[model samples]
Target: MSANASANSFQALVRLLRYARGYRRRIVAATTCSVINKIFDIAPEILIGVAIDVVVNQEHSFVARIGFTTPQEQIVVLAVLTFFIWAGESIFEYLYKILWRNLAQRLQADMRLDTYEHAQRLDMAYFESKSSGQLVATMNDDVNQLERFLDGGANSLIQVGVTVVAVGAVFFVISPLIALLAFTPIPLIIWGAFFFQRKAGPLYADVREKVGDLASRLSNNLSGIATIKSFTSEAREAERLRSVSEAYVEANRRAIQVSSAFIPVIRMAILAGFLATFTVGGMLALRGDLNVGAYGVLVFLTQRLLWPLTGLAEVIDLFERAMASTRRILDLLAVPVTVKDNEGKPLAEPVRGEVSFDAVSFRYAASGVGVESVSLHVPAGNTLALVGATGSGKSTLMKLLLRFYDPQAGRVCIDGQPIGEVSLASLRQAIGLVSQDVYLFEGSIRDNIAYGRPEASEAEVIEAARTAEAWEFIQALPQGLDTAVGERGVRLSGGQRQRLSLARALLKDPPILVLDEATSAVDNETEAAIQRSLAKIGHGRTVIMIAHRLSTIVHADEIVVIDGGRVAEQGTHAGLLEKGGRYAAQWRVQTGAMEESEALG
Candidate 1:
């Protein structure tokens, strides 16, 4: 590898080790087994040399010097020793496999879970900038890449190191000249491995990126399948997916070309080392300069030493891929959380739900379209409605209150306490939000309703569903509340999904409830049902509603008309109508349009 890239891979590995510090004891245990297993594995080669000595030297054998005088006795001794060596190898081999594989499973699961939790805590802006498929790829694919390396590659590397060191020591003690010549090609092999590593490093990284892109394309397509079918763009989407898939394949092909050449290069280098030991060691034994048993040891050990080096190509390939994945995974873990929870105090008990947006201003980093110095307040038990055209920053105000994106200027408070000074858990728990884009999990209606309060009783879930005017339709289904919602509630109608979302929020029973276009998806009858429910539901809790439909908020205690991220007007429904401004203009258009439809009917 180039010094710079090698250093980066090394740094990435170091970072991974630091992150895995919790598993240090398990790592040490696994590595100890690997090293001990290699020792026992190499012992059999030594035993073969000793058995050769017993056959040729008899009484003059090395074992005879150690007090076993007969060749038969020494042979039996070697047989028994071989059995134990092989047994030890088997035992430790099993041990290390269990240790390393279990470690990989546990570490990968923990890393994925930790990464997901951290991602959840990140600000909404971060999610807006990233694709869901890319995040899933990192959490699943990249983490699995690391697990595959740990499962086998790590043990291979450790055993290779042991083979080189243990065999090299034996070679030097037997005949330094043979050892020098036999070891000559090792430097070349090492250099070539690193050289290919440098080339493969960047290519593997590109392969990973291309895989992420492919994942993103797939995720986007699957999620929008209905849209593609409706628009008859299935063929176009298939072509797009094919393009991304081809890009991933091409990247893999490039990486394979470089990694595949390493094995052949290493094999030639190993050949040089093997031939040197064979020729020179045979010459030495013929000249009586080397003991026969030791010379035999050198011949066998030469292959044992150099053959493992050839496998370095595969090990290095695995290492490079792992390091690439590690860098991406750790880089995600290192992303600074801009919206930190400061571990601040919780909100006061019996949260009165008095909410205020004090001169709040926020601009989207990419679009620069957000609220501009907007401010408003809603007293406890009061309903305040936000009216605006689409993209007029109505929902941005609600997001600020929820701390999804902190305002660039000013503060949002509940119960006269600034939200930024409170713990995120406490602040969020105080409010329940049902957004314009309703989302339902792929589960039963009851499960979705009780999601925010899973411990809630069945009676409680039923009441929340009833309050959202969803219980009637839910009862009509064959499975009733147990009916599957399907993925993102695709099985349900838009209005049904909307009601379920409202039911979920109501189940939470937060002190403050925020509904952003909660009834936008419903038919007129369902809308009237929800309106009547809201009249009763708002009796004890604060309600903040953002609506495009003027009729929905006609009875709100106060209505604030937002225009271009600023408050254009604010008053009670009757008062705003008398002012004949923005609110009045919007009301007339909506009501007049409704009246014409009624007359036509």
Candidate 2:
């Protein structure tokens, strides 16, 4: 390998070893078993020579020198030794397999979980810029690839090293000349492995990238399956997916083509060592210069030592694939968490519900759309509504309050303390958010409702559901609260999902509630019921509501009208209507649309 490539490999290995640190004891034990197994595994060749010596030398065999006097007794002694050797080999083989496989499973699981947790702690911008499918591929597919190598490749490599040492030591004890000849191919094989690794490193890295891209394509297509069907573009999507798959296949093909040439070339090198040992050792026996049994041992040991090197090519193949995957997995874990809680500050206690935006401003680094130089306040236990057109600052203001993104300018304060100075958990715990885009996991209805507060009692959960006006429909289902919501709550209608989300927030029951178009999906009647529920429980809590449907916020205690990222108007709903400005124009258009529809009907 080139120095640069070697350095990269070493760095990757060090990082991986850090993950394996906790399993060090098991690793040592497993490694000891592997070495012991390979030692005995190579002893069978030496045993073959012993059997031959017992036949040729009879009472004068090496066993006689050790203790036995009769050939029959020596043969019996050899049998017992052989039995133990094979038994030891078999026992350690079982141990290493169990140890290595279990290690792979545990390590992979831990790596996946850490990567996912770190990903969650990253800022919103990172996720917005990256592909979800690629992230999923890293957490699932790439980690699995690394696990596959740890399953067998790791053991094979250790055994190969043991074979070289054990067999070479035996050969040198008999004849240094034969040992030199038998070991001639070792350097070539080692060089071939390094050569293949350096060449295959980037190829497999590209292969990993290609596979991740393919996964991204598939994820996107599946997520947009509804849109694809509505547009009748299945063939187009199929073509795009096929193109992505072809890129992956071609990348793998390049890696395979290079790796496939490895074993055969190394096999030829192995054959040269085997031939030299067979011819030279046979000649030594003919001249009576070496014992026949010794010659036999040399011949057998030579092949055992060098032929396994051919499989080294396969081991290197697995190692390279694993290293590629390891880098990706490590890269994910290495992502800096820019959105974490301030370590210098602790979460606030006894939150009062008052909120303020003191000249707050924020602009998305990527999208360039955010609230700008805006200021507002809602007193403790008062409802405030923010109304604006799309691309205005309504949602951006809420995001700042939630700390999903920190503002570029100004401070958002809750009950006099700047939120940025409070612990993120404390700030989030103080507020409940029910957004327009409701998401429910693949679980029963009760599970999604109690998501925010999993330890809530069944009665408390039911009461929250009733508060969101979702209890009636949930009861109509055959399983009631236990009914499955399906993927992203696709089993329920939009309004039903929104109500469940409201129930989730209601269950949280924080001091402050932010409802951003939370009732958009529900009909007027259900919306009214939810508003009534909100009105009842919302009395004691500060409410920050964002709605494009201005009617929902008409009853809010204070209404702030935003236009072009600035506050255009602020008053009670009646006061804004009396001003006859933008708010009046929006109210006229919406109410007129409703009236015309009713008249036509």
Candidate 3:
């Protein structure tokens, strides 16, 4: 990796460690267990040295210095202490495992939930720019990577530090000379571990990015498989996917190259430390400055302390990868929601569905291009139709009214109250919407209909379906209301999906209704049935309908023709035709279709 990439990885680690603030207690407990375990594990080496002294020096051994006086009894004491040390090591190992694993699981669950909740609260504009698979990869795959690291690598890292500190103290007390020799290589080992991390971290991060891209491509392709096959573009898509896969593989391989070199380099450092300690300590024993047993213990302890350092590279690698994922997860959680509830008095009474937009303007975040000042009104118990060519800001108007994106200028009002001053939940509750691009969850027909009103009774659901003119087709299904609608309602026809969307709105029964090209995809027969249902539902309710089909809105109580984001004309259908303007031109084209239908009839 380049120097900039290495620096970025370090910054990512710093950001990630900040998220563990909430897990401080667990981390402390786990670290304590790891330290205690290493302390106990170092005791066995001391015992081995004691056995050597008992056999060689007998009563004059160092065991006599502790008042054991007899070699046989000293052996017994050493045996019991060895058992206790091993047992204590085992107990702390268990404690560390339990604590670290629980911590890992808890952090994973909390982070995933928080990320998902934050994503939900974000503005719709953010979702428009992001892919579902990329978000899923962050929430699942990246989080799982962190959890796997915490499950073992965290404890290993803590234990390695404990080993170095505790064993270093022992070696110093025994013989500072040999301790210096053994400790000489530790700095080099640590430096090598860090050097490897600096190289591998960016490679792992790139690997993760490549995986996210691959997931996005797979998800998009699968969702559009029908179109791909229709156009015979399967081979092209496969080749594209292969290229992405190869990029991911190559990134991982680069990381492996650096990671694979870590252990061998670390092993050489350990060898240097080991040989220095062994040769020097043995020569000193021969010079009568150190006893045979003491020399034995020093050799065994040096190996016990330094051998584990060889595995430090692997643990650091895990840490680096986990830190990369953690940074992404934290960044997601840190994204502030631009759209939030306003602090205002709650509505005491139900809304009357009076909607008014006073010179509202909006621009998408990506392009900074938007509609200019525009205004319209729909009083209670009235219907308003918006007709325009594409890009004339028809849909943007609906989004502003719904508070999906607040307008940069002017105000949107509901029942005489500016929507910006009202709680978002209560404001949305007062309105119902049905769009042409209908979405249905993977569930039974009844569930899809009752989605907006989950607590609605079965009878109420059935009644709503009947009002939407969907009950006839629903009852014809294999399981009546219980029939499964596959993912996004794929099992249902386009017309059926529209009816289900209408049923959902009827169930909501909000005083304000929006139909944005709701009947655009259905056949003439289905459209006629839906139009009849809309007529019944629109009575005494405020309705705003946007449509390219002029016939759908010719009977609306009032029509507002939008051109270039401004209201160009406002009148009933007949008034517009008499005026011989844009509305009339659109009406002429639609009426031509009607004339052809009549001739066929």
Identify the candidate with maximal lDDT.
1
Residue 504, candidate 3: how far off, in angstroms? 1.1
Q: Estimate each model's TM-score.
A: 0.98, 0.95, 0.96
lDDT tens string, model 2, 112-140? 99899888888888888999989998999
Q: Is candidate 1 or candidate 3 better by TM-score?
A: 1
Report, for every candidate in turn, its global Cα lDDT versus the true structure. Answer: 0.91, 0.89, 0.88
Ranked by TM-score, top first: 1, 3, 2
Summed over model 3, clashes come to: 0
Clashes of 1: 1
Clashing pairs in 1: 1-194
* Candidate 1 per-residue C-alpha lDDT over 404-489 given as tens digits, one digit per residue, 9 for 90 to 100: 98889999999999998889999898899988688898899999999999999999999999998889999999999999999999
Can you write out model 3's per-residue Cα lDDT over 326-419, one digit (the tens) per residue? 8788888888887777856644476788889998888787876556788887888899999989878888899988888999999998888888
Model 2: pairs clashing at backbone N, Cα or C within 3 Å: none
State which candidate, 1 or 3, has the greater lDDT: 1
| Decreasing lDDT order of the candidates | 1, 2, 3
Candidate 2 vs 3: which has more lDDT = 2
